[model samples]
Target: MGDLTFEDVTVRYGSRRRGVTAVDRVRLTVPAGAVVGLVGESGSGKSTLARAAVGLTPVTGGRILLGGRPLPRPGRAGPRPLQMVFQDPYSSLDPRMTVGESIAEAVARDVARGATARRAEVTRLLELVGLADERAERYPAELSGGQRQRVALARALAGRPEVIIADEITSALDVSIQGTVLNLVRDLRRRMRLSMLFISHNLAVVRYVSDIVAVMYLGRIVEYGPVDQVLGDPRHPYTRELLAAAPDLRAVGSDLAHVGSDVGDGTPTGSAIAVGADRVRIALADVEPADPHHPPSGCRFHPRCPIGPMVHPDREICRLTEPDPEPHQHRAACHFAATVETAPVTPARRSR
Candidate 1:
């Protein structure tokens, strides 16, 4: 069974005139001992979802369950069963506290261990994150970016949480250092049997660490499935676009320099229209443009969609109607997902 589940979750900020839904009806199941990647572009709601999971961000609607039971609201629940590793490690750590003290404090609060045991655990946690035991005596200001990040990770692990939400934890580090941290997290996962929700915009990193991948676009999950199936044979246009954006070393000097076409003006065409199936076709003409403050009527993607002459399959309605997420083994928000045939080459223009 999954260790965490998000059921019809939605999060919006502010009153009606100023409100924006950061996450919209998002559903996810994070299986125990598995690493799940939440991949998307900036403003795709990845961070918001991460915050919601640990009660850092209030849930505007819906429920979050841990071990099949509802999670307590923030503050009321004491320390969370889950921990988070922020993107900016330097800012996340305390400048005043020594690394050992920071880790020890976290251990004391979350693990309920005594001071002696906390000190011992701090030493082990620092080592587990690849920092030498002596480094623990240093302050955050004394450490390098990578070392500081490792310290932050150690503090998060001090809680021995069943789940860890790493929000772009490696994006700020050097490429060389990134690999080291990635390997450390992978090793720790195996050693501790952890369930992780890894959030990142880097597709390559996500592919490397995630057992399952979910692609988000403008606050909604456009595609979700096992990592191999979704990465190897992507079913959603947005997912394909993300894969295309990932740098491929093998194609360094090859003709496949560019992966997909650019959808300027948000108008989708060419490969965006899925062919070969009897699925309902929802065309772009039926809907209006997306407004961050007030999104368009019907399908959120319709203004940019290329498909034409298609009606809602289940309801026989026009593109002005919202379509439910596909009910396949893998899920997609597009109404015409089943009918769309993914092409090897996406339509985006190549980068020079």
Candidate 2:
């Protein structure tokens, strides 16, 4: 297995000149045998990046490499080296096919050419995901949400992939069911040494499973680094705000709490972060995100930034220049990133 690298990937939609750019010049990696978590808001383009990696979406620029080579085109295939498990299990699977048939269809020809072999493979895959062999005869509607998600994972594994992209796989499920699916993913990673790009809004879940974490805003990656360093010692204002907004962290007690404990064991003691954090209930919270087709000038985040312009008029560099992601232990795309660690956790000071 090799690293899955996205070098300056860009994805645009509709007319190139007038369309929206969903994913903008993203550079990320899912190292072999590691899980990289992608976290962001609703329109952050995490799903678009995942789709592009699997050829389900076209790239307008840059390259997606697997083991240092371009990913294979969709139809020109053997067993797919990369596979995606989509967010919605209900729509991802076909109602016409039984669970066995769905998993069997993705089975590599070499792995299961004959009918008996296919059945065995299906049974094995089912059991691999903690499902009973007999459940293969049931339709998708017959199973619960968690069970269906496991089936979706089982289908992705059927391709014998080197990497897996799980796009909000638990967002649609209840909390109880969500935990079971997360547990399965953690277990599978241990058993298979799977390389993954896990996308989600839940910071605690990401902390539990990811080795690396990449934070996105709008269509850009604003911060990224190892899980502990990135989450424990966030350098980006958006990352700090994101971490502070987490219910788990806020409830846990303080910011330093997550830094010491809450290292992905599922039982996070406290959630709200106190360091470099400023919860924007009335300020950044009310400001609408700018149009992706025509993002804000200079820094895309300046208008909502807690440390720029409205918050500190003297700090005008954020409005006059675009700061590239810094080269450091924890990278952040902010002109004042060097001072973020020292930035005080003030009350919401209305964003302009």
Candidate 3:
């Protein structure tokens, strides 16, 4: 009953004629008791998917299901089946209401208990989030940044939701505090066996928190699979690029560096494909992504694909036809996924 499925879900903003397509037929599943991490750039629609799932944002096409049933509208009377822990805690919390009152309000949604019982439940929730009973008497303004974020989590949990969409809950905290919040989230998820959709731009954090990982670009899932498979040995060029950009502690004195000099003329501008480069161009390094309103003709990532020019079998096809989401070793939206998987690994250069 804890499965959260997105069946070809799509979300677009504005009118159909001039709409900006934010999410494009994304299909993902967060199985019961598993954390599925969604990682992407700012405009990549990670937050939009979370918002759309809980009915905060509009779902233009397809549907999101909870435990095999369609999600009910918000404020429909009963306990909410899904909840969200927002990125910004200060804005989400009411400055006027005492923390206890806020948690009590959510408790009252399901519990018919009197003030005494509600207070007990509030105290329990505060404890669950590692907050003290005394802090419950304070307003949102009195809490530190991390404490407020915990309150937001406690309030979300007060609904006893089956699915929690945690949208970058640690992005606003200091690194030290971020670790604390992450530890709390991991501990709580384990204790409650909660299903979660963790969204973040931090690859390292995503790697640590997720059982499954979904990588988004523009408005599409470019890759998704078990955390180790997706991040440890990524098949998508974008995923590879992202991993290469992240600092690897093991690469300090090793020859396994991914750095290389630019190989192409570097003259091509905009999001159009360049066919003249003889070697790999590290396309994403220089190319500007296409506007969402006018994505490329074929593959969405073709314009900025590092190996688009180097791969012969699928090169022309990638420029003319859209590749369906192929699930082999893992799910990837690239036509050359097979080739990428079988491609020989480049030898690590000696550190000079």
- Assess candidate 1 and give its TM-score to the true structure: 0.83
Q: List candidate 1 segments past 4 Å from native.
A: 109-113, 249-289, 308-318, 346-352
In candidate 1, residue 24 scores what lDDT? 90
Candidate 2, residue 65: the lDDT equals 98
Q: Which stretches of candidate 2 lie over 4 Å from their true place?
A: 250-272, 279-286, 342-352
Better of 1 and 3 by TM-score: 3
Per-residue lDDT of model 1, residues 244-292, tens digit only: 5555512221211122222122222233222222221224334544675
| The candidate that achieves the highest TM-score relative to the unseen native structure | 2
* Strongest candidate by lDDT: 2
Clashing pairs in 1: 260-348, 261-347, 261-348, 261-349, 262-348, 262-349, 274-340, 281-310, 298-320
TM-score of each: 0.83, 0.90, 0.86
Give the range where candidate 2 is weakest over 10 consecutive residues by summed lDDT: 252-261
Tell how far residue 324 is off in model 3, in angstroms.
2.0
